[model samples]
Target: MAVAQPKIDLAESLLSRHAAPGPGARWAQEARAAAAARLRAMGAPVRRDEYWKYTDPARLTAAELAPAAPLEPEKEALYGDRAQLKLVFVDGVLDADASDALALDGLTVEPLARALATDIHWARDLYGVLEARGQDPVPRPLAALNTAVAGQGVAIRVSARVATPVTIVNRQRAADSDVVLHHLILLEDGAEMTLLEAGPAGARYNTCLEVDLGRGAQFHHVRTQGRDNERHAITHSFARLAAEASFKAFTLTVNGVLTRNESVIEFTGDDAKAHVAGAAAGDGRFHHDDTVFVTHDGVNCESRQVFKKVLRNGALGVFQGKILVRPGAQQTDGYQISQALLLDEDSQFLAKPELEIYADDVACSHGSTVGAIDEDAMFYLTSRGVSKPDAQDMLVLAFLDEAIQEIEDDALADGMRERLAGWLARRR
Candidate 1:
């Protein structure tokens, strides 16, 4: 009998096909090669992997690409009225022709390909360094693959406070496109910025973003992932914070065929703070997952995680979050909560929340809940002359409002609220 290939070996085999080296400078080439080697050593995630047990990895790791049509989202503009700088990308390649001026007054934007050149840049040092550091305690083969084969992306550096938000808009056009993009962002000491993003890139894509915040720096990110429900994506955001630095990120996901967003953060300086929140909605045949890991190594640091998801029509939602407090992390305050609303009997939600603390004195807590909609509230709304569909939607949006309100900026928060309302309108 011919021996069947082991699942681990098969997984590695599939990743190898996507590992062919791309053109770049010697340093960039070497970095990619090293990352690819690490990915092979770690092997691709399979159903056997504990972290991937809830969702099948076969769809994401298959050797052949899936066919997908480009999406036009004229009606899905979330921040259309905002007067912020804009950068455009098509199929993961920076569309210079479509983007505004590359050089702003206080910041510089350049293609990530420059890191491959002989001239040394901060990006060259950070290209895959943060992702490599995050591999410990958990192996991320996808992140490693991105470092090794990412074809195009952008490099942004901020030295002063940016009054205008910078938006990265993605547009996909081609069937069966496979896009790998790696983004690098550096915020110097005392710098601040707000990043706005909206779009669905392609049928299949892998994206890795690395952000390094210097002492006393601040970074705010708000994103919407509602358009083009057919896209499948795997994304990783790795962030490192210095003393007194702040990082806040919020994501609003509409329905999608498959999506897994992972965020990993580490506090290396004392008094640093980080907050992450997400609100997602799904219909039948949709699958969305959020996996987050936050580590507190600095004394007096604080972190928070709040996630809310709504699923109906047999859709599936997943959340896996953890907070780790190192030995020296006394006076640390960490909180986490994950909750879901199942609108129908067929809808499903799966969540895993954790806390690992080695510190002697620290306050850390986590909570998870899954339940159906409240009939009493529904009855009250309907009795007030509100139709059932509208009443249910109002309740659903109210459930998501808590997470959305976390955005500090009033304008940004209002924009997100409008998007949520539009989403409910479409569902109606």
Candidate 2:
């Protein structure tokens, strides 16, 4: 007879030891335990999983990072020279001493644990609803691990008719530790808010954000990730839009050992619209991937996705986008485009844009292109006496400029452009 292998009761073990139950940590413990059970039942994802085939989660997640250690003086310098509303979280705890941005009138920025401690309704409503829509059989191990030990994160809510924007800055200190999951929740109805996110940590960090938009609500979310070469970062953002609500997002990834970002938006009511765009620059041995899923469950919803990538050396780039139209989603207009220019043959990219529609009246389209630097354009510029490196950088900026300009904040857009040029110059 074959020997019996030991089975691990992960849920019970985590609940008994790692569960941080407190005033603000209300249902977190229970939800975490439940998620642990789900993960245990499903096991870790392998090469066979469809969504995870290209990127191997087994090697990346073989060891769980501990809570981040305290920040050193040099690590603190990472957050320097950025103008935005800042919310600093050290380790798994929010750093109240480092923030100076006061909450504006009609706006609330509090700790997620605090909100649940006083009243747990909001936390309960948002955490587990979206898991039902995606029919994938495998349990998300990363998500489960995140929920299991999610310490304190930030939360912001805008009252009706409020127009002020809130910026949340997340920083990680350098220290060998288990993974840190940053959970953020944003709520707006008849209100307009913008989130300017800054992450300049040189440590391993994992972040998760969930946003809910009520009727007529508008949001502008911008995220910047600039870390050192040793850090590994993963971020997931989920949004639910009501009737006529508008959602806009811009993401910038500059430096990291491995960085992956996932954005999923659901049109829960009719007439909702979403605009998403991002720019990523990676060089050397770095790897970056941006995956998105836009689902239309109601009638007359609109969505547009545009992603640009600048890769050099032996770096790898991946972009996967899917647009799904449910059975009764009539009059849906969905468009997606992913384009990348490889600076050399060693650099690589993988782009897959997919569409699934059940309604005959819907219009959905997707296109992807990967090519070398345009020689014609290079010649046109060089004929004017521009250097080879300068010409290549110009074409790259022009290619990515379309999406960068979509950002309404002039200051942020210009800052991103300047940084993009700088990165290209350094690589050259």
Candidate 3:
């Protein structure tokens, strides 16, 4: 069926026009041009779009960027690990002088701009390939816009085991900053690495990360969006896994006015395993949403998704997730669950979980739930001399711990626990 004429007109009116790629490698420029064309054909975000019907899309499509005050540098880092290599971005501009050298055994990390300057590079083939492949089932126009005019990011190619994990740190120092970045991650056969990201790029930002996993590769990603009260953000992650590849990713979002994160994953080869999970907390006019799609096209692949949210004082949370099993994809194992704890009657949690299977022998299941904090547990803790607020905090931690345990690394899980505990402490 053809899209109505009014839909095209609305998309054109709401879509922001980004600047063209300048003097980059021929391949990058050509790719950007193609992406821009696709964005135009797709149109802008409208209420008619089923994927965005619950959330308002006007702010995302607005032409002007929002103003976000720079947050004071924290004396104690959120992650509290100084040994890891830190790639810093200030106001959306990559800071090369202050960052750790882009050198690691079996990995090549280059600035997107620099990669575009070279005559030939593997990034040329992956810059926007996986993102385009994820357009089906739903069209992500904001992601397409990021691809068309992403000015700063990194391209990482990993071919062997890396001894150290790399963290991407984004810092916003200026108000009304418009930040656009796209990162390409390519893992060769038998490669392994851990990728971490944190911070708010700008008041309004569009960020995209595309991951391509070769046979037998292993990749892990853990990210913290930010604690900025005035910030609004929309981000997307697209990943493709090959045979025997393993991918695990988790995100923590706290204290943003509005945040919508979309994740798309596809298993193209048999025997691959993937896990995606997130934990979010919001209060006082906060709104958070996570939309995810996992596709299984190969036999014997496995996938799991776990999400938890805490809301209070009229705050809102949303989760829309789906797992798809294609024809001939036998022995697929998929599981998904999303839950929320509401501290007050005014708060709300919206969830939609789905499973689509063509093969009769596969096992796929999903569940979603929203409920108030466990009063019995809260009373049990309060009876032990804990204050009401402190008891509530403990219960909230216990509720979210299930999702945090999804991280296999002990240190990483410890870091997540500390951050969540700190946030809860402040609120109490």
Error of 1 at 224 (Å): 1.1
Candidate 3 lDDT score relative to the true structure: 0.85
User: Candidates 1 and 3: which is better by lDDT?
Assistant: 3
Task: List the candidates ranked by TM-score, beginning with the highest.
Answer: 3, 1, 2
Model 1, span 134-221: residue lDDT tens: 8989887789888987867788898998878888887778877777888888999988888887787667888899989999999998
Q: After superposition, how far is residue 190 of candidate 3 from its true place, in Å?
A: 0.6
Which candidate number maximizes lDDT?
3
Which structure among the candidates has the greatest TM-score? 3
lDDT of 2 by residue, 190-279 (tens): 777777776543256556677788887888887777545555767777788888999899988776767778788899999989988989
Better of 1 and 2 by TM-score: 1
Clashing pairs in 2: 65-177, 65-178, 65-179, 66-177, 66-178
306 in model 2: Cα distance from truth in Å?
A: 1.0
- After aligning candidate 3 to the native by TM-score, how far in Å is the CA of 404 from where it should be? 0.7
lDDT of 1 at 303: 96
lDDT tens per residue, model 3, 280-374: 99988888889999999999999999999999989899898999999998999999999999999999998989899999889998899998988
Model 3 Cα displacement at 40 (Å)? 1.1
Candidate 3 residue spans exceeding 4 A from truth: 1-16, 75-77
